[model samples]
Target: MATLADRLDRCYSGAIYDVMRDMGLRPGVLPRTIRGLVPDQRVAGPVFTVRGRPDPEVDAHTSLLEWTGLLSRAPAGHVIVCQPQDDTRALMGELSAEALKLRGVRGYIVDGGCRDTELIIEQGFPVFCRYTTPVDIVAAWRPEAFDEPVTIGNVTIRAGDFVLADRDGIIVIPADRAKEIIARTEAVIATESELRRAIRAGEDPQRAYLQYGKF
Candidate 1:
């Protein structure tokens, strides 16, 4: 049987959004600032959440070690969702992206900044972030927590939740409800496909919606 991640990977973000809304799980999309660097790249996986901030007491040496540890321990087939409280510096760079890819990390989603845009794009490692900057977390930033809940754009994401992202946007599904959401989304896709066919065949919009109960 296909895993939850595999099943989610087969659906686009729009369908997932519709299914979640129909199920009453509102506020699923991440902030508009977080966009895929490669808009065509679609990724779906379990979330490995990280929450970070600039610490006045954590020295540079210790901060580096802490950040390194967090990345090194990222589980295979997971997407790293980070909420770095500061936006002045990049939380992810080329080396980190390479390491995550080597460990089978599906992709990254950061509600902050990222660097090494050219190389990251060339490598085709899917990354979604607010923006890019040359400044990095060498001095004061450190992850305060991992594998915990983090909020981005009013959507609370917890570790083990499912993330589906594409050119349209990113949608987070509650882990317990992911399977059911996927099943519903498949039905939605099928209905939409048929609706498209009917419209192209010159069927009236009102009749189509009446027949399909959707349009």
Candidate 2:
């Protein structure tokens, strides 16, 4: 399987942005809680996603160790995308990030909060989440599920879908539509590039946008 980086290079992040715009999704940074923890780090990959919900039963638990095991064994170049049921509480922290980095995992995307933002950003590991908190998971939450469909913002993410995120925002490309999206996104990029060049060369920006469908 092609790594996320490899596929992204072919289609380009700008192209993905175009697709997202075409789909009527507003692009904004996910909440600041998600951050990177490695030097010069950015992660892009097909999402091996999981979702979790709060459980009152203390015994209803899924071990992070087990999840790390899957990360370690995952095919090289895949990302572990996680969606937490509770957006207000931190679910991942420095320890979990350290294990993921060591396992050669790409990065994480969560719709919830995370701890250790400073260390994570200093280390340069890429994480995207909703908020940051000082909370821990000892009694607050549990990882009760894996490899399931999850929602982040307005996007529905499935276990095997392709995810591309950067400074702009994250875009989810369905597994079955990957190839088609890639092709369309590439075309959008080319069109926009030409329009940009024309505008830079003194052509009317409005005319360019009207002709190309985007500025």
Which structure among the candidates has the greatest TM-score?
Answer: 1
**Candidate 2 residue runs with Cα over 4 Å from true position:** 1-5, 9-14, 20-42, 56-75, 210-213
Error of 1 at 74 (Å): 0.5
Instruction: Report every candidate's CA lDDT.
Output: 0.90, 0.66
Model 1, 117-170: lDDT tens per residue? 889888889999999999989867998899999999899999999999899999
lDDT of 2 by residue, 9-70 (tens): 46645577667667675533333344443323455777787776665544414444444454
Please give the lDDT score for candidate 2: 0.66
Q: For each candidate, give its TM-score against the true structure.
A: 0.94, 0.76
- Against the correct fold, how does model 2 do in TM-score? 0.76
Residue pairs clashing in model 1 are none
lDDT of 1 at 138: 84
Worst 10 residues of 2 by lDDT: 27-36
